[model samples]
Target: MTPSESAAAASNDTRTRRSRLLDRVVGSLWPSMALHRATRLMAGGQAIRAFGLFARAARAGSAEAEYQVGRCYLNGAGVPVSRADGFRWIERAAARGHAEAEWILAALYVDGVAPCCDRQDSSGSPLDLFSFDVAPEPDFAAAEKWARRAAEHGSADGQALLGYVLTFGPKSMRDLEEAQHWYKLSAEAGCPQGAYGYGSSLVQSGDSEGDEVRAADYIRLAAQAGLSPAIYLLGMLTERGWGIERDQSAAVQLYRRAAVIGNRSAQTSWGRALMWGVGVEPDRIEGESWLRRAALAGDADAAALIGDIYAEAGALPPNYAEAAIWYRRAAEAGHAAAARTLGLLYLSGTGVGRDPREAMNWLGIAAEAGDRSAQVDLASLLLNDGASHPGDLAKARDWLERAAASGNLLAASHLGVCLLEGIGMDREERLALQWLHQAAREVVSAQYWYGRALSEGRGIEADPSLGRAWVARAAAAGMADAEAALAEMMVNGRGGPKDHGAALDLFERAAAKGHVGAMYALGMMRDGGFDVASDHAAALRWFEAAAERGHEAAQHIVGHSPQQNVRDDR
Candidate 1:
C-alpha cells in the first residue's frame, strides 16, 4: 500500500474507536440525564422530553436510573410530585444497592418527607424527624436498616446520618456508642460535618475534658469549608471561651465573615459587638446599621437590640414617639425586650400614649418570655392597681421573685418595698431589710432607701449618724433624694455641723438643675428668714417656679400667698 493510504487507514481506525467509546459512556449516563431533565420540568424550571425515558430506565432495575427517576417523582418533575412514587423508586434503587439512593433515603427519613404512597407507608418503621409529624404504623423500619447498610458500605453522609439516628432514636434504638462509632468513621473519611458531630458527642456529658477544643477545631474546619452551621458554632465558642481561651476579637472577625455570607446568627452577634463595644469600639450608628440589617433578615436578637437602643435615650432622640415605633416593630417579631419596652411606654406615657390595658397586654407577653425588666414593671403595675389591673399581686410577686432569682438588683429592691409595704407580702421587717441590703449592694436606689429607712426608723432602728453617713454615700453616688436629705441635715446641724452657706449653695445648684424638692426647700428657707435674710419676694419667686414645674405643695403655698393673688389680677 502507498504511505498516504496507510495513514488514512490508521485515521479511520482511530475515529471508529472514538465513536464506540462515546456510545459506551453515553449509555452509562443517559438514564440519569433523562431524570435530570424530568426534575427540571417538575420543578417548574425547565421542560424537556426526558421524563418518560427516566421512568422506563427506572422500572428496568437500573439502580442509578431508579435513583434519578425517583428524585424527579419526589420533586414533581413534569408531573405532580408523588411522595409515594418517589419513595418507592428510591427504595427499590436503595435495595438494589444504589449508593446515591441510599443517601437520599436517609435524608428523607431524617427530614420527614411526607408519604404520598402506600409503599413508603407499608415498608418503613415510620419515623418522623420531629414529634410534630404523625407517627407511622405499618412498621417496615427499613429506613434505619438501609441507613446502617449504606454506612457499612462506606458512605460518609450515610454514616453521619446513622450516627444521629442511633443517638436520638426511640428508647428501643438509642445507642450512644453506636452513634459515636459511626460519627468517628465518617469523620475519619474527612467529612467536616461528621467531625462536628463526633466532637459534639464527646461533650454530651458536659465535662470540658478538652471536648470544647476539639469541637472548636472541627467547627473551624467546617466553617472554612463554607458550612453556615460550623461558622456559627465557631463564633459561639470564641465568644464564650468555650473549650478554648476566650478571643472576642477573633470571634468578631469570624462573625463578620459569616454575616457577609447571609448568616443570621453571625449578623446578630456582629450587631451586638458593635452595640456594646465587646471586642470592638461601640458605634451606635454602625450598631444600629447591623441590627437593622439583621432584623430585616429576621434575626430576633438583632430586633431586640434595636428596640432597646431606640427606646432608651442617649445620643438617640428622647422622642418616646419614635421609641414606641421601634419597640412595636421588635415586639411584633417576638422580642420580649421590645414587648416589655412597648408595655412600659403604654404604662408611663413614654414614647407612646398611656393605656394601662395595652401595657398589661404587651407586659404579659414579656413576663411569659422571662424578661426580668418586664417582670418588675408588670409587678409594679399589678401591685398598685384596682381590679382593672388585669394581674393579681400574687402573680406580680411571682414575677418579681423570678426577677430577683435572676439577680436583678432593682427587682430585688422593689420586691423588698413590696414586702415592707404589704403590697405583695406581709411586712417582714427582717426579710425586707435583708433584701434591701442585697439590693443596696448592687443598686443606688436601694442605697437611698436604706438611708431613708434608717433615718426614719422604718422597719429598723433609727440612728441619725448612721443615716447621715448612708445618705451622704448615696448623695455622692448621685441620688437626688440622698442629696436633698443630706443638704437639709447640713443646714440644720442635725447629722453633722451646720453649714448654712454650703446648704444655700447646694440648694441653688439643685434648683438650677430643675430639682423640684430643692426649689421648694430654698423657697421655705427664704420665707422663714433663716438662710437668705428673710427675702419673701425671692421666696415667692422660687415657689412660683416650683409650682410651674408640677410641685403640688408649691402650687398650694403660692395660691395662699398674697403675691400670687396680686399677680393673677395683673
Candidate 2:
C-alpha cells in the first residue's frame, strides 16, 4: 500500500472517533434528542444501533431511555437477555417516575417475569401476554404496591391490571368494589380488558336489570375490540336474551368468531350448535373436530359432550369404547354426569371391564355431588350386593332416603319395600304405607305392595274394598304378584262376594304369567273339583309345573300321589 493512503486511513479513523465523542457529549446535555433518534432507529428495525443510542440516553439519566434499555435486555433485542439487569434498569426508571416503567414493573411483580416483547403488534404495543408463562413464585403484595402507584400516575393499563389482581387474588386481598372502581376508570380510558372485567362483574352482581343492560353494552365494546372472552360472553347473553335480544343465529356466529381465536368455551358452544343443528346446519364431523380441539385444551364440558356423542345412537352406531375414553377424561376432571355414566359402563361391562368396586367409587363421587339419578343407582347397587358387604344394606337405605327426598319415585318405591319387609331396618308399617302410597301413584310395583298391605291390615285399618280396587289396578297393569293376590282374594271372598267363575279366570291369567302360587292354586281347584268338573290330568300337570318352580305344597303332592306314577307311565 502507498504510505499516503495509509496515513489518510489513520486520519479518517481519528476523525470518526472525535465525531462520536462529540455526539455523546451533546447527547448527555440533550437526552430527549437521543431518545427520539433511538425510537426512529427501533421503528426502522435497526435494533443494535437503537440500543446504543438508548444506552447513551440512559447514561444521561433519561428515565424513558432507561426503560427502553431494560426492555431491550429483557427481550434480547440486540442485547443478551438478563432478567436481573433488566429488573434493575426498570426499577431505576420506575423510581424516576416513568409511568410506563411503573406499569411494566407492576406486571413483572404480578407475573414474576417480563412480558414477551415478541408478542407485540406492528405498532410495538404489547398484546395479551398476560398468560404466557408462570413464575416459580409470585409476589402479589409487591405487585399490588407497584400497580397502585402506576394507577395513581394515570396509567390505564395499570388500572386494569390492578382491577384484575384485586378481583382474582387471595381472599384477604380481594376487594370487588375497589376492583370495580379501577375497572371503570380503565374502561373509560379505553382499555378492553377493563371493559370485559367490569361487564362480567356487573352481570354477576345480581343488581337491577339496568345494570345487566349496562354490562351488555360494556361487553359489546370489548367484543368489538376483539377480546375473545368478551365475544364468548356476549354470545351467551344474546342466546339467553339476558340484557340482549335473543338471536340464536347471531349467537352462533359470535361463538364461531371467538372459537376461531382459541376460546375454549366458545369452541365448545360452537361445536354443540353445529352438532345439534341449533341455529346452524348439522355437521357432525366438523362439530366433533371443534370439540376435540377444546377437549385437548382441557375443557371438561367439551370432553363430556364428546363422550355423549359417541355413546348416543344417532346417525352412526354407538361407540362405547370411545365414549368410555372421553367419559373417563371428563370424570377425572370432576364432571358429575361423566362420572355417573362411566360408573354405569363399568357396572355393565359395556365398554370397560365389569368392576363393581370401580362402579361404586365413580357412582359415589357423582352421588356426593348431588346427582339424584346417581344416588338411586348407587343405592340399588348396594342393595343388590348387600349380602356380600357388611353395612351395605344400611348405606343403601340412607342413599335411597336421600334420593326419595329429592322426589325420585323409584327410590321411594324401593325405600318403602325395604321398610315394609324389614330388609334393612326395623319395620315401620305407617311410614312404609305412606311411602308406598306416594310412589304407587306412578310406580306399579309400589301399587302392588301397598294394596297387599291394606288387605292384610298391616299398617292401617283393613279397607278390603279399597284394597281390592288397588290390587285390581295393579293387576290390570300386568303385575304378576297383584294378579295372584287378587285371584286369592276373589276365591276366599275376603274383599268381595265369592265368584268361582271369576276366580277361575283370574287364576288362569296369573298362571299364564308364570306365577308359582297361581299354578298351585289352579292345581288345588282342579283336584278338589271346586271350580270345574274334576280333571285329574290337568291337576297333575299344574302340580308338576308348580313343583318345578319350587312350590313346596305342589312338590309334596306331585311326589306322593299315586296318580303321578300313572302319569309318568303314560
Candidate 3:
C-alpha cells in the first residue's frame, strides 16, 4: 500500500466513528424533539397529526411524549377524554423520572381524581404545584408522603412545596421544624417560593435571636426574585420600621410595584396610603378604585377602609347606610375598628335602626380588645340603663374607672356625677368632690357641680367668693344653670355685692335660653321695678310664659292674678 492511500483510509475511519456518535446522541433526543413538534402542531390546530405523533413517541417509551399523550387524553384534546388511559400513561412516565408527569400523577392521587397510590411509582411519590387545582379532594397525608419523596430526589420546587404542605397541612401532619429544614434547602437551591416560605417561618417564630434579621434577608431575596407576597411583606416591614429603617416613601413604591402584579395585600395597602396621603399625595377616587379591587379579592382591611370613607361625615358626603353595610362585613371579618364603628352607628341610629343590644354586643367586642373610646361609650350606656339592676352599677363604675385611668376627661366627669348622684351605688360626697375638682379644670359641666358644692359646703370648706368666680366661669362657657345661679346671687347679694342691674341682664340672657327660673325672676323684677321700670303687662306676659312651661311658682302667681279685663290693686 502507498502512503496517500494509508492517510485517506485513517481519515475515513475517524469520520465514520464521529458520524455514529452523532447518530447515537440524536437518537436519544428524538423523543423530546418529536414531542416538541407535536406540541407545535397541536398549537397550530393540526390536532389529528399531533395526536398520532404523540402516541407513536409515547409507545416508543418517551417520557416527554407519554406526558403530552396523557394530558391530551385527560383533557380530550382532539380525542375523546379517557381518564383511565391518561392515568396509566402519566404513571408510566412518572415511573421513568419525568418531573412534570410525577407532579401530575401525585396531584391526581392526592385530589382523589385517581386512586391513591400507597407505595407506588419508582421515580418518587406524586408532588404537585398548588396553582393547578384541576380537581378537588385533598388528601394531605398522601400529599405529604409524595412531596417528601420529591424533595429527597433534589427537586427545588418539590422541596419548597413539601415545606409549604407540611407547614400548613393538617395538625396531625404538620412538622414546622422539618418544614423549615426543607425550606432552607430549597431556598439555597435558588427557589423563590422556598425563600419566601423560609422568611415567613422565621418571621412567625417570634424568637428574637437573629430571626428577624434572617427573615428580612430572605424576604428581600424573594422580593427581588419577584414573589408577590414577599414584596408585600417587605413593604410592610419597611413602612413599620420592623427590622428595617422606616422609609414610608419606599414602602409605598414597593406596595405599588406589588399591586401592579396583582398582590391583594399590596393593593389594599397602596390604596390606603393614597387615600390617607400617608407617603403619597392623596387621591381618594383613585384610592377607592384600588380598594374596590382589593375588596373584591376578599381583603377585610380594604372593606374596613371603605367603611371609614363612608362614615366620615366631614370628609365625604355621609353615606351612613353604605357605611353600615361595609362595617358589618369588615366587623364580621374581625376588623376591630370596624366593629367599634359599627357599634357606634347602631347606638346612634345613624345607619342601621336603633338596636341597643346589638350595639352593646359590638361594643363589648371592641372593649375587650382594649379600645379606649369603646370603653367610655360602653360605660356610659351601662350606667344609664343598668341603674335598676344590682351590681350592674358596679360593672359600669369599673368601666368608667378604666377609661378615666386611661386619661379620658369625659369619663372622669361622668364618674364624678355618678358618685355624687349615687346613680347605682352609695353616694360618696368627698370622693365625688375630688373627682369633680379634677374634671372641673377641663370640663364645663364639672365646673357647675364643683362650684355649687363649694358654695353650699356640701363636701368641702365653704368658699363662696371662689365658688362665685367658678360659677361665673361656667356661665361664661354657656351653662344655663350656672347663669341662673349667678344671677340670683347677684340680685340677693349673697356671695358678693348687690347688683340688680347686672342681675337683670343675666336674667334676660338666661330667659332667652328658656330657663324657667330666670323667666320667673324676670317677671318679679318687672313687677317690683327692682332693676327696671315696673310694667304690669310685661310682668303678666313673663309670668304666663313661665307658667306654661310648668314653673310651679310662676303658675301659683298666675293662678292668683286677676284677668286681663279686670283691675288689680298695685
Candidate 4:
C-alpha cells in the first residue's frame, strides 16, 4: 500500500468503530429514558431500542409505558405479536387508572382479543398458572367493568363507548336511559361520538326537553366535528326548515359533503335534488345512479322515488313497465304509496296485465295500511261489478265511510251517492244532502246532483234559482248531465225567464256529447216549432238517432208518432 491509501483505510475503520460505540450508548440509555423521549426515538426509527425502553419502564410500574408496550405488542410493532403479553400489559396500565389503557383493556375483553387459557406443559399436564384448562371466551361483564373505570377517570372517548355499549350492546345489558346519561357527560366533555349520539337521540324523540333548539345545537357541534351522520341530519333539518332557516342550496351542499363520505341517506337526498332540479341542475343519469346506490343500500324511500320519477309522464316519456318494477321493489319494503300506485297500474293494465284480483289485493294492503287514496280506490272497485267477489256494496260503503271520515273529498261524494240511492247502507236523506253539498264545492258530478236535488226539492228546500246557477256552473265545467238539466230548465223558465235560443244552444251542446235525453228534447223542439221553424224531417232524423242509441222515449216516439206533431209542456 501507498502512504495515502493506508491513511484512508485507517480513517474508514475509525469512523465504523465510532458509529458502533454511538449505537451501543444510545441503546443503553433508552431503558432509562422518559416515555415521551422513548416515543420520539420510536418515531425516529429506533423501534428496537424504543421497545426495550417501553418494556423496562412498564416493569418499573409506569402506566403510560405499560400501555405503549401493550399497544405495540397488540399491533406487532417492533416485536413479534403476543396476544397474552398485550392483555397482561394493558391490564397492568388499567389497574393503575390509565384511562386509555382501561378503555383498551375493555375493548380487548369485549372483542375477545386474547382468550385466556392455561399455560400447560408439553406433557399435557394442567398448569397452575390459571384456573381454566380451556380457552376463555369474550366476557362483556369484564368489558363493562373496565369501561366504567375508564369513564370515571375522565376519558371522553371511554364515556362515549360505554354509552354505546349500554344502548346497543346485548339485550341483557342494554339500558337506554343510563346510556343517555353517559352520552350527555361525554358530549359535555367534547367527544364527537357522544355529541352525535345525544343529538341523534334528541332529534328522534320529536322534541328534546320540549324544544328542538337544544337538539339542533348539539347536532351542529357534532357536524362541525366532521361526523357524517350529524352532517346528514343537519342537511335534513336545513332542507325542512326544522330548527333552522330553510335553505335548499345549503342543504344540497351539506348532502353532497356527506355523500362524499358514503352516507346512504345523503346520497338519496342529493340524488332526488338532482333529479327534480331542486337547488341543482337536472342530471337524470347521474341522479338515477345515486338513487340506485341508495336503493341497493336498502332505502325504501329511494326505491319509491325511483318509481315516481319513472311514473311522471311529463318528466320522462312514461315508462310504466319500469315504474312498476321500482314500485314493486318499494312495495315489498312496505311502502304504502308504492303499493297503492302498483294497485292502480294493475287496475288500468298500464304496465302489467289487467288483473282485478291482483289490483284488489294490493289495494287492500295499502288501504289497511292507512293510505287514504287506496281506501277510496278500493271502495270504488268494490262498488263496481268487476271485483273477484261480486260487488260487495256493504264493504264498499264501509271503506268509503272510512276514507270520507279521513277528509277524502271523492270518498265523501261516493258515500253521498250511496246514501241517496240506499245502495249500500239504509237511506239517510239529510246526511246524503249534507255530503252532496260539501262535495259539490269541488266535484262537477256532485254539483249536478246537488243542483238537481235542490231544483226538485228532494231532501232540501226548493231553490230553483240557485240550483239553475249551480247547474250552469257544472255545465260550463263540461258536465253533459248538467247541460241537459240546464237546457230543460231554460225551456220551462223554472229558474228565470227562458230564452228559446239559449235552450236550443244548450240542447245542441248536450246532444253533441251523446246525451240521449238531450237528443229527445231536441227532436221535440224541432217538431213543435218552439225554437226554430218546424222541420219534420230534422225532428224525425233526431228521433231515429236517439232511438239507435237505445233511448226508450226516442224509440216510442219514432214508432208511434212518426208524422204526429207532439208537444208536451208542463
Candidate 5:
C-alpha cells in the first residue's frame, strides 16, 4: 500500500464532510433570510425581486411566503394575474393552518372569482392557457369549512365573514342565532363588519327596549367606523324613532352621507327628502338626479316614486308621458301601485295609446296583487265591455264582490247595480238595497239608486216622500238620473206639491247632460204645455233627440208623427 495515496483519500473525505456541513447550515437559514428580504423588497416597491424571493421561500415550505406569492399572482404584482395559480397557492397555505390564508380561501370560494390561466404572452398579457370558458361556480360548503377553520383559529375577519355567510347564505344554510354568536365574538374583537351585522340582527329581532338600545349602540360604532350600510340603517332608526329620538333632519344628514358613497336605499331616502322639502330645502333637479341613479341600479321603489313625482303637480309640471315610462319600469319589476296607475293611463288614453286589452292586463296584474282600486277599475271595464265580451260580466261581478268585501264603497255601488239589473247574477233585491244603502253615504250614484229603490218599492216599503228628498240631495250634487227622477216627482206631485215651472227647469238641467229619459219627458211636457209654453217645433226636436239616443217610446212617437203634439201621460 502507498501511504501518500491513503493520506490524499483521507483529505478528500474531510473536504467532502466540510462542504456537506456548510450546505446543511445554508439550507437551515435560507428560507427565513429570503422571506425577510422579500418583505423589504415589497415595501420598497421592488415587486419582481420580491416575487422571486417569495417563490424561493415557498419552495422551502414557508406558509407566509406561499400566501404572499398567491397574492402577487392574484394582483399582478410581479407577473400577469392568474387566479388559478393564486387559488392553488392560497389553498396550500390554508392547508398549512395559516389563519389569514384560510379566510382568503373562504372569501374566494364565496365570491366565485375567475380562475384564469397562468400563462402570459410575449407582451406580458394574460392568456387563456387552459381554454377555460367560464369561472368556477361558488362552492358554499367549501367556503363554510374554510371560514370555520379560520374563525376557530382566532381570526376576527374570519369570524365576521363566517357570520355573514351564516346569516345571508342560501336558504337551506341560514342560521341566524349562530350568525349572531359569531358576529358578537368578532365585534368584541373590533371588526366593523361584525358590529354592523350584530347590530342589524338585534334591530330586526330585538325583543326588548334594552336590546334595541344596544343594537343602536353597536350600529353607531360601525357608522363611526365609516360603514355605509350601518350609517343608512342608523338613519332609518332615527327617522322612525326606533331606540332613538325622532329627528328627521338628522336622519336626512345621515342619509346624505351614505348616499354619496353609492348606497341605493340611502340615495332613495335622500332624494325623497330633497324632493319634498321634508327635512331640507326642495331641490327637484338634484333629487331627481339621485333618484335616477338608484332607479338605474334597479331599485323598484325608487322607480315607482319617480313615476309619482312626475305624475303629481308639484314643483315640476305634470308630465304623464315621462310618468308612464317610469311606471312601466316599476310595473315590470312587480310594483303593484305602479301597475294600477299604468292601467288607468292606458284605459283613459292619457299619455298612452287607448288600449283596452293592455288596460285589462295591467289591471288584472295589480288586482291579483291585492290592489282594491285596481279590482274595482277592472270590474268597471269588464262590465262596460259585456256586449263584446259576454263572459266578462260574471268576472266583473267576481271582482266587484272582492273589492266590495274589502270595504270599497264604489265597488259596493257597482255591485248593487249589477244585482238589481240582473247583469251578472239573478236579481237579489234585498241584497241590492242593503248594499246601495251602505254605499249611499259616500257614493252619489248609490244615493240615486237607493232613492229609486225606495220610490219603486223594489226591496223595501214604498216611501215616496223620503225617496224624493234623497233624489233632491243627489240632484243638487249634479247626478243626471237623480235630476230627472226629482223632476218627475215634482211634476206628478207624488211626494210634494207640484211645481210645473220647477219641473221644467229640472228637466232642462237633466237634458243638458244628455239624459235620454229627460229628453222624452221634455218633449211630452212641451207638447202638452204642462211645464212651459207649447211649441210644436221644440217638441219635435226633443223627440228626435231622444229617438237618436235609442229611446223606444220617443222613437215610436217620432215614427208616428214628428209634428204631432203628444199629450202628457204622467
Candidate 6:
C-alpha cells in the first residue's frame, strides 16, 4: 500500500491526526467502484504515492469513493471533465445517502453544470428532479443538507469540514452552535484536524482558552499519524515542559516526524535536537544539513541556529569561516544572533574582515531587538571597555544590567569584574560575588574570581577548601590564572597536596591548551629537572616561550639573552 493509503488504513491507529482527512484512507474505506475511480483520477492514477489505495477504493465501488470520483470530474482531474457524468456519479452517491456527494451535487446544480438528470440509488430508490441554481440558495441548502447527513452518519472528516465551512466560509452560511457541535463530534471521534482546529478555535483571540488534556490527546494522536502542524506544537510544549514534563525523547520524535513530512518549523527543531544530542544521538552533518534545508525554506529560527552553529560553539563546535557564512545568511534572514555575530566577526576580524562600523551596525540591530548578549557587547563597545571597542561605562552598564537580569553568564561575569575593580562604578561586593558565582558555573575566569572571593572571604564566608576546588576545576579547564594557582598550591601543599610531579603534569597539559602560566611552570620544571633530564637548553627554550608572553618570572629568568638563560654554569 502507498504511504497515504497505509495512513488511512491505519486510522484506527488511534495515533493519527492531521488538517485534512487523507484521500488514501477514504479510498480504502469506500464501497463504490465508480467513486473510487474518481478518487483515483484525482490522484492522477500514478503509481507514485497514494495510488494503490485509490485503485482499491475504485474496485470497491464505495459511496465516498464515488463522491471523490465526482469531485475529480468537476475539477478535471487526469482527464477532461464531463459535467453530465460528474452529476451522474454525484447523484448516484447522494441517492445512496452519501453526504459529501449530496454536497457536490448541490454545487453542480447551483452552478447549472448538469441538467435534467435523474437520481437513482443502489437500492433502486428514485427522487424527483428539481431545477437548482447558485442564485436560488439550493447550493447552500444542499451543502447544509448533505453536511447534516454526513455529520449525522458519524463521518468525522465530514463533521470537521462542515464545522470549518460553517464557521469561516460565508457569513450568510455561518452557524456557531452547529459548527461547535460538528467540531465536538469530530474531536470525540478522533479526528486529528478536528481536534486541533477546535482547540485552537476555542482559545484563539483570548486568554481564556486551552484544554491541555484534550488538546494534548488529539495532538498526540495526530502527531503519531504524521501530522506536521500538530507535531510541531506538541514538540514545543514537551520541550518546554509546558503542558507535559520535559520529554526530550517525545519532542525529538515529533520534530522528526513533522520534519520528514515537510513541516518547515519541525525541520529546524529536529535539526536542533540532533545537533545538540538533546533527545537523539548527536549528528552534526545531518543536523547541519537539515538546518540548512529549513533555512532555505525561509525559517528564520533555523537560519539563526545555523548561524549560531557556525559562529559560536555549540553541539557541532565552532568554525569561524562556517560561522561567518551562517551568520551572514541569518542576518540576511533577519535573525538577531546572526546580526550580532556579524558584528562580532567584523570587530574581531574573525572569518570576515574587521570593520568596526559594520560591527556597530549589526550590534545596533541586535541591541534594538533586545538581545541581552548583544546589548551587553554593544553597550561595552559604547563604553569602550571590551575587545578594543570604544568605552561608555554607563551605556555598557545598562546593557549589562539587562543581560545580568536575564541570566547571561558573560554579562554577569563582566559585571562582577566591573564591581570588583571599581571601574566606572562604585564597589558592590555582594552583587559582584553573586554575578561571579553565576558566571562561574560555566566560565573558567569567573570560577577563578569566585575562588578568589572564597579565599578572601569577599562578600562571602571564607572557605579555603572550596576555593581550592574551584581553582582546580578552572586549572583543569586550562585557565592561566587557575593553572598558576593550582601549581602554586601543589608546590606549597596549601590546598590539599604538595606533588611536584602532579603539578608538572598539569602545567604541561595547561600549556598545551595555551595557558601562559602553564608555560612558565614548564619553564620552572625544566629549570629544576623535575620530570626530565637537567637540560639547560630546554629550560632556556621553555623560558623563552613564557617570556614571549611577557611573563615577569620567565623574563627575569631569561634576562637579556636566550643563550645566557641556557646556564653555562650547568
List model 6 lDDT by residue over 1-570, tens digit each. Answer: 899988877885643343123545554565353344444544565422233343355357656656655655566764356666567767778878886676455445445454544665578665333334333333455556666676777778768767766776568988766787787788888888677656545433224324555556666666666667878988877887654678889889888988998999999988988887988999978998999999998887888787676666655567887777767777877788778878998999988788898898899888888777889788767654443432455667878887888888888888887786665677888888889989999988889888877777887788867888888888878787787777767876775767887787777777877777778877777776464446677777888888888899888888865577466655
lDDT of 4 by residue, 90-133 (tens): 98899999999998888777776555456667899855433345
Q: Model 3: which residue pairs collide?
A: 106-126
Model 3, 1-570: lDDT tens digits are 699999999999999788556434543567666667678879999776677778867877898889888998899987888877788888788778876676667666655666434533468765432223455577777667666766887877778878888887789888899999999998999989899999888888748847877888888999999999999999998998776778999999999999999998899999999988889999988999999898778787999889888878764579999989988887887777888899999998998999989998898787777777787777777876774466656767888888876777778888887788876667888988888888888888888878887888777788888788888888999888889898988987877888888888888889999999999998999998586788888888899999999999999988888763365553
By summed lDDT, which 10 consecutive residues of candidate 1 come out lowest?
131-140
What is the alpha-carbon lDDT for the whole of candidate 2? Answer: 0.87
Regions of model 2 farther than 4 Å from truth? 1-38, 48-155, 169-175, 383-403, 406-408, 421-427, 471-570
lDDT of 4 at 125: 82
- Ranked by TM-score, the better of candidates 2 and 4 is 2
Candidate 2 per-residue C-alpha lDDT over 198-293 given as tens digits, one digit per residue, 9 for 90 to 100: 898888884898998999999999999999999999999999998989999999999999999999999999999999999999998999999999
Residue pairs with backbone atoms closer than 3 Å in model 2 (clashes) = none
What is the number of backbone collisions in each predicted candidate, taken in the order shown? 8, 0, 1, 0, 0, 21
Q: Which residue runs does candidate 5 get wrong by more than 4 Å? A: 1-183, 314-317, 379-406, 418-435, 454-473, 488-503, 532-535, 547-570
RMSD to the true structure for each prediction, in A, is 8.2, 8.0, 10.8, 10.2, 10.2, 16.8
Candidate 2 vs candidate 6: which has greater lDDT? 2
lDDT of each: 0.76, 0.87, 0.82, 0.82, 0.87, 0.72
Evaluate model 1: give its TM-score: 0.68
Best by TM-score: 5
Model 3 spans with C-alpha error above 4 angstroms: 1-215, 260-264, 276-278, 296-300, 313-317, 351-358, 387-392, 485-570
| Residue 183 local lDDT, model 2 | 87
